[model samples]
Target: MADVNPFYLGAFAVYLLIVLGIGVWGYTKTSDVMDFWAFGQEMGPWLATWSFVANFVSAVSVIGFIGAVYGEGYTLMTHTIFGLMLGTSGLYFAVDRVRNLDLLTFPDIIASVTGYEVARPIAGAVLLGNGWLYLVMQLVGASLLVTAITGVPYEYMVWVIGIVFIVYTVLGGLVSVAWTDFLQGTVMVGAVLLALGYMIFDFGGFTAINQQFAALDSAYVHPTGEGAYTAIGIIATIVAFFGTIFTEQNNIVRIAATRDVRTAKLHLAASGVILSIFYSALVILGGATTVALTTSGLAVDNVDSAFPVLITDYVPTGVGIIIILAVMSAILSTTDTRLHSTGITTARDIYSYFRPDSSDDSQLRVSRIATIAFGITATAAAVNPPGTIIELYNFRAVLLTSAFLIPVYLGLYWAGLSARAILASIVTGATLGVGTEIAGGLFGVPSTFIGVGAATLVLIVGHFLLSDTEPKGGTMAGD
Candidate 1:
């Protein structure tokens, strides 16, 4: 902990107040379950685009993953390429179709396509699990930013951040989340761009960075640089992230919120371009951070401290506050979405499935309650975070993708997909995916690739081998 700048603290207080004000505004606009969950499907294309980009570049990307780029070297840039590819797929494949669907949540689509009553709850459970995991990771990163700037205890800051999120999200739901996301997204881009600009101006340019890295090792400059990542490793990383964009509940819900299919496409297209620039800047900033830290003779106890340490040591306090707010913006934007999505999964996907007779009004009430419950649980997990932010993010994304990836894509396009086949795929995929991840580097590929591969194989084999009935032609939207 260190002494805080009065101006920095005052600026952050104002930012939080503004965020709360937006939440209150959203509370006024939200009327029912549909409004609460999806903002009545009235989102503008640019708003949706910014929301998607903000969610995509969460606290993990702003802080922890940037640290990874610096510590791990240029080879890790493959993940950024994978993220860009994910955005492209969203534009061409996901946006048009998902927005047109009558379904409300990912589980609704799952059950509809598979024609299974059980699939809904299963999907809900996985959504809740992964959502909480991601929420916890963001909270950890947010608390780190808070502690660094305000000199607050990390444990205390975790609960404080959680409480503020719960208050706004519970009161306002998706409407609040979306509005806040738009503002946060704008701030996030500007903050990061400024940080990058400052780094280039203060530290030497790319040539100087390379010279600094040369003193360390030449591999830092190479694509397939020295580290744990290989060609297969890059593919595996790509596969995990690509699956996240397509199959994750939080992302899918954003697509469903778009005003129309055309708007969805436009939003996705715009998001892809924005993300490409954002991620490229992040990668370059990572390289610049390594150079800055080395030249300044700063001692980083943990690699995850790179971004925060760089700002504190090299940048002025006023500018540091803006950068920290940017980090907060990234964390809050993503965290609110996970919170809102978890509530929807619990109330709409799980509870409503079990109690089909429940009214939308009661469901809305339950959703608000669930939002608070999830916030508390995630805050507890953040108190003692298990890994670096990127590790948590990647593992949770892989877990959800393993369970849903094969079934979701195949269900969308392949008419013959069966409920039984989906069950087998999810179960088998989880087993192999977790097993591979547990087995570590000796397994030679990311757990996501292994798990997704297993799921796809089982699904295809079972569809051909097990079904004696004739081909059933139907789309996920219709089913």
Candidate 2:
């Protein structure tokens, strides 16, 4: 049997206790269906800021992103960061607009924007689909962290983590998720900074690490010069980042939870700045890992294992546990929100579609049931496991961004986009995106680009093709 570190286990237990305490408190505070799902639109800017940033830093970022940079080098960050900033700034513009609409669900916003009743259900289906895959990815990430830190069997860990996630989400809804996110987001940032500090101090210093990287290869410093990832790949990363930030329903719910339009905009700006700094720091840390690995003549079979190896090998057991906790935080931070979002989507989108007159109490009841059901299904899938965390996330990114990115953006900005055109755009883009992804990298372009291109083509052609008959009512017209 592998030895267990008492400090690690103790720390993990304390973290779980705190999270559960927060969930129980939030449950007590939740008075209505709106309060449960949207925090009653009373969230302060700081909490909203933390939750917004937390929404983006999933296990994929902690495990997959760090490893990618360690293996590939600078090009990963060059466009990826730019895309994140672009998306955040775009969302900043959307904050007031979204708040003003005061919709119950994200799909309702689409229906409002397009003046089409049909747009709601389409958006709902897409969000729920994305939520399922995303939940599975987070489950995989949590299981990986547990197995690495506790020497637990991966299959057992998935069910264990899955049940915990379901319980918290079904108990407290978005209110609990937001407060817990605030706590975890702070921990995640602190732990990452600590990890970087440890690496730098252990490896002599920044100067020493930089010299080691230079000694190894100059391509490590050049943005587009190293590894298998091409400029095209970078472009796809940007699109994924931009699309996810702009269109993801989880984020929309976060924004809706804020006090007002002004608070929402402030939170978005702050979250963007925070996200940029933290992610940039991660890039540097990844590069530092590359230097450390090369200088020590140590290597791991999988790049995703690089950070874990660095933590367990070099850092003290106490600090290493904190780092492990941070990874667990990263996994839970996103997983709970995704689970909650799925419940909301199922309740408001699917159940409401069938029974439009269902009471709020009834909706809440269905949401809890759906949340538990989705969590269990994702847990079952996690036992089998499919691929690396990043790969799974990237797969969903294309599928999600293609289906909703263009439609949402166009619905928000373009008055001429008809209900028919928006619907057609989502259908065609999603179809092409999934088909091309399965077809595998035809024409040297990523599936994301092809899918987005297909959507954009239909939007433009269909708009001009059907301009005279398009709907006249829009957000701008009423305003």
Assess each prediction's global lDDT (C-alpha) against the native.
0.80, 0.81
Error of 1 at 156 (Å): 0.7
Residue range 193-261, candidate 2, lDDT tens digits: 888888788888887876777677778678775655677878887897788787788888887888888
TM-score of each: 0.94, 0.94
Model 2 Cα shift for residue 173 (angstroms): 0.8
Lowest lDDT 10-mer window, candidate 2?
Answer: 470-479
- TM-score (C-alpha) between model 2 and the true structure: 0.94
Number of backbone clashes in candidate 2: 0
True-structure RMSD, every candidate: 2.4, 2.7
Lowest lDDT 10-mer window, candidate 1? Answer: 470-479
Q: State residue 90's C-alpha deviation in candidate 1, in Å.
A: 4.7
Candidate 1 per-residue lDDT, tens place, 145-248, comes to 77777777889989988998898999889999999999999999999998888777775676676677656667776777765566777777777777777777
